[model samples]
Target: MWISLVYLCLYWAFFLLLGLLLVVFLAYCAYVKYIHMKYDHIPGPPRDSFILGHSSFVVKASDNYKVMHDLFLRWAEEYGPVYRTNFLHHVLLTCTSPDSIKEYLMSPTCPKDPYAYNRLFYLFGKRFLGKGLLTNPDHNQWYKQRRIMDPAFSHKYLMEMIGVFNERAEQLMEQLAEKADGKQQVSLHAAINRVTLDVITKVAFGLELGLVEGNKTAFPNAISLVLKGMIDYMKNPFMEYMPKHWSFIRQVQESADLLRKTGRKCIMQRKQAMLNGEELPKDILTKILQCAEQENGLDDEIMLDNFITFFIAGQETTANQLSFTVMELTRQPEITRRLRAELDEVIGFKRDISFDDIANLTYMTQVLKESLRIYPPAPGTSRYIKDDDVIEGIRIPGGVSVNLNTYIMGRMDKFFPDPFKFDPERFHPSAPKPYYCYFPFALGPRSCLGQVFSQLEAKVVLGKLLQRFEFELVPGQSYEIMDTGTLRPRDGVVCTLRPRETASQ
Candidate 1:
């Protein structure tokens, strides 16, 4: 009788466990149902698959989806400026309306999306841009660093760097001169990339990378590898774990380490020099070191973060912008002629383009603005909503990622008529200002600190090229965009240059 009771008790225990599991499963189903119903009222494209959702459609765009900006552009047209898309369980709402953009980006309550920025925090199990001004999602921490770094990018300081800018831009012209005979096709993007790379290294840390003169440097190649790794990680975050990608992942990690190690060495040298009472040049590094000393060892990692930050930001974005500008100029001869006329009147074959000259080249300024509108280098920014919000009468649920894509917004016919046409008049001084619709360098307090600095460098480089040489696009070269971290000309702006007859005369 006792043995029979034991068996009965065991049977009851098993049934009770089964009943508990059923309750848990039903509860989970109800929660998921609630989530679907919450966003069901919102308009969006149907999920392309149950597993990948609309992200499958986006990733499937493959080559054309280079930067993913094209995907956003297509969806914006289909679902209007504001629509929701999903990547797995995460809901991403893209907004192109000026008012909506201003509200979310400018609000203190909204922070940079942790999910998006966290990807940049590490690259293949290595510290990449940890707590840098760009990737730091913590608003208070970012604000503090921004305050400390502000003086380095001040108007007076940037004006002082014009000599260095001209020096580097002139070196690029010398290199281009060899290829300007019109027979050899030149990759303007490659050449400009070197110059901008050299310029940032020299002006920021007072180190001459000598990349413009065609000297091979580890830093340049390392940066390239890191960028490639960034694109790969963005496409597949689990790439590092895959057997096929191990080699590439290892290379990226080594490159990131090389960058940080080099930065640490430079910081040590600079610190030692300060202790030795050596007179230091007033460069960005000098200013950063000063701020670091004040923090009393607290800002060591922060210092390294900014070091990488300035190098990448100061070079790649500006080079790509200049490359896109050249592509546009080659396509539009009438605009080039007008731009050349303005360059002649203001610069007049001057070897050294000054800060004041940048202001005087009004038409060139407009041309640059228009180029950015059509081909934004960085493309977009994102914010994480902490609370449910209403945007254009559509309710955006809390915890969803909101993307403000300048590339998509810039291409919209509602914001810019004949949007694909490269027109400088849209940015003419007398023309209406593009309130929140056009933000190549982004908008508000968190906007690029290097905006003015970059424009100054671009004007110097492009103006000198305009004054020295006339370039034509090589036939049969594709003008596709390549989104490797930043968008660049896929064919690297292949061109054959001939010295302008007017300049020769």
Candidate 2:
């Protein structure tokens, strides 16, 4: 019995690898025939290996996804603005030119590449995200959804959401005050995560976990498991397919299922309370749910996907942006003081900072914009070409994924006058460049669903914090960003905060 079991296991392992070998051979043959021979005009890297293509180069780069961006930059330098690279024999073409981005992102022909972006399904799950607007490849559905949902960002609804924004910002200030009461090295890594997560819950679900009260969370383990599952599936297999029944895939599906179940319960509970004639709080979450209910009540899967997407999108990106902005401001006191002076002018201590006050925060918004430019949370955006296309006179064959790297784009001297300098003044309304040239949230129809939400949260959070706190970088500490699930600081951001006492006058 033992010998038979061992033999069975060995046979399965042999067959699994053999099957992979066969798939690579077929894909390679098709590549050589259709891509290399037929579309020889495309510029790409020299073949690295039989199966991996440039996969090793990608994995070996210090910043995992940034590798492709770096390579694209080098090739663009050599081959021109548009270039292609073979990622695990799956061809990928990249673009960085502002003109190129405008042409493609706005064009009807270029669709999001599912093969390149299918890795996202692990986080949002197959069922919930199967056809949701963000991940869906179907242009018609995206157009329809965008039409229906885009109005949520209209000025009136966005203004209605500001009260929750201010409330969350106020709560964050109180928490920051408590943390700085000790004046020790406080890990902003922890603080920002708590604030953003709380903001997402309150704004996206009409639920408040009140996370900062304690370190414990009911969903932390499950969320971590989901993210881990995403990395495992996307990395280990690469473009080489993995079995659908793989353990990590199963875990990701299960965790998304759990988050969805809880989210649905919360949504239903809110609806039931409304049925009981209870007044739901006025906020983005309430508005979103009301919109969902009014759209004849979408399928629960889509509802859950949007909720999870909002939580992740609405949470991590804003938090990281704030954290990095704080990190930069603390290090540069000159810039911070300029920022504070501007803030004082725009937001007087005569009363609490109101929505109207936030509008006049021109420099603060510039500071936030520069930070996002420096360390964009989602550094790269991707698309798949379904038909052969030419850009800059280079033929890009179909079935290729293209990653446009905003991080590298920010670094390019062409994009900004002094690329590496953190000059918020560059964002002054009088700045030389056009608005379409800079896209922290992508421009055009398929841009970030929560652009307004993100901007409001950042402005409110940073404005409130700066109003109350004098932040300075602690000496002997250097902050470098790491490419985590989001672009996060490699080490914790440590800053000393002294309360800005307003009553002395």
Candidate 3:
């Protein structure tokens, strides 16, 4: 009799548990439906699934290896300037309006999207760029670090870097000279990447990486791997737990760890030097240490965070920009001729380009600006909306992710009449400057601190290239952009270089 009673009780308990799960599932469905209804007024592409939202569309496009910005461009054409996209429960508002761009990015109170920035804090379950200026979402904390590091990027300090920039660019030219035989195909992207890496390492940390001289360092490859891992982890959050992905995940983690480890070692050495009464150059490393000291103690991890941040941000975007500029120069001979003429006139045969020469390379400056318009390296940024806002007659609720994309705005027909044309004349001094539409380095107080630094570096490297070599693109190479964290030329900008007949003396 007792056994029968116990069996009956077990049967009732099992049904109750099942009933509770069903109720929870239904409640979740209701919540998703209600959330979707909130942004129903905002125009966007038709949803593929009620629960999944646009995630499947994104994943499918990613799987097909389609450039995401192309999709955004298409949608912008279809849905108008301010539209909404849903990723599961999260609502994203992609804004291309100049007015909205100014309000969202220029406001000091505007906060970075935690969901997006925090993900970058780790790459495949390993600490990467933790609470650094780039990934730090706290406005107050970011301001403190930015203030401490400001002197490192001041005009005086940047002027001091011009010599280092010229030295590195000269090294690159020497390396390219051996491979300048017209028959040999060279990857300008890869070569320029080495130069930028070497420049950042030497100028920022006072370390001579010698990447341009073909030093077999794992740092470059590690950075590439970490970027690839970032994309993978972002596209599929569960990738870290999947057994099939374990090998790549392990590699990404190790690469992240290696970078942090290197940063720790470098920081410790600098600290020791300070203790030994050795005077330190007021470079980025010294500035980083000062930031840590201001925080009441030397926080190696935080200092390392900025170290990795500088290493990646300082090198990658500038390298891609230079590479893209070379690719365009290869394609447009008229533009190339004009640029070479400007380089010849301003800096003819001058191997060491001075700051004054850089200032006077006006036409070269326009060309580089045009390149950034067409192919921005760090394409876009995101902000978290804390309060309700109205943009372009559409009401964006308080809790939304607003995407501000230079790539999208740069290509719009209304903004640029001939959007696809590689015309440097658009950026001529007499031409009207794009209002808020042309933010290759972003805008407002949170704008890129390295803007001047990057452009100066770009000018030095590119001016030397134009003065020394005539390069032709290898046939059948695609000019398509590849999004690997940063947008890069899909074909790696392969070219065959020949010494310019009127090469610099």
Per-residue CA lDDT of model 3 for 1-505, tens digit only, reads 9999999999999999999999998998898888898888999999999888888878876664456888888888889989888887788889888998898889978889999989888787788978988888799888887887777898877898899999999999998889888879999999999999999988888888888987889999999998888887888888888899999889888999888888888888999998898999767787667665776664567678888888998999999999999988877989888888888888888779998998998998999999999999988999988988898889888888888999998999899988999999999999999989889888988899888889999999998888889888899888888888888998999999889973433
For model 3, what is the error of residue 490's alpha carbon versus the real structure, in angstroms, after optimal superposition? 0.5
Show how many residue pairs clash in every candidate, following the order shown. Answer: 0, 1, 0
Best by TM-score: 3
Q: Is 1 or 3 the stronger prediction by TM-score?
A: 3
Question: Model 2, residue 229: what's the lDDT?
Answer: 55
Best by lDDT: 3
Lowest lDDT sum, 10 consecutive residues, model 3, at 291-300
Query: Ten residues in a row with the worst lDDT in model 1?
Result: 291-300
lDDT of 3: 0.87
Better of 1 and 2 by lDDT: 1
Candidate 1 yields a Cα-based lDDT of: 0.85
For the record, the alpha-carbon RMSD of candidate 3 to the native fold, in angstroms, is 2.3
Q: Candidate 2: which stretches are off by over 4 Å?
A: 1-33, 62-75, 123-128, 220-225, 238-254, 271-278, 292-294, 434-437, 501-505
Ranking by lDDT: 3, 1, 2
| Model 2 residue 249 lDDT score | 63
Model 1 residue runs over 4 Å out of place are 1-34, 294-298, 502-505
Summarize candidate 1's per-residue lDDT along 165-262 as a digit string, tens digits. Answer: 99998988888888788889998998899989999888888888899887888887888888888877887898777999998888899999998998
TM-score per candidate, chains pooled: 0.92, 0.85, 0.95
Error of 3 at 234 (Å): 1.4
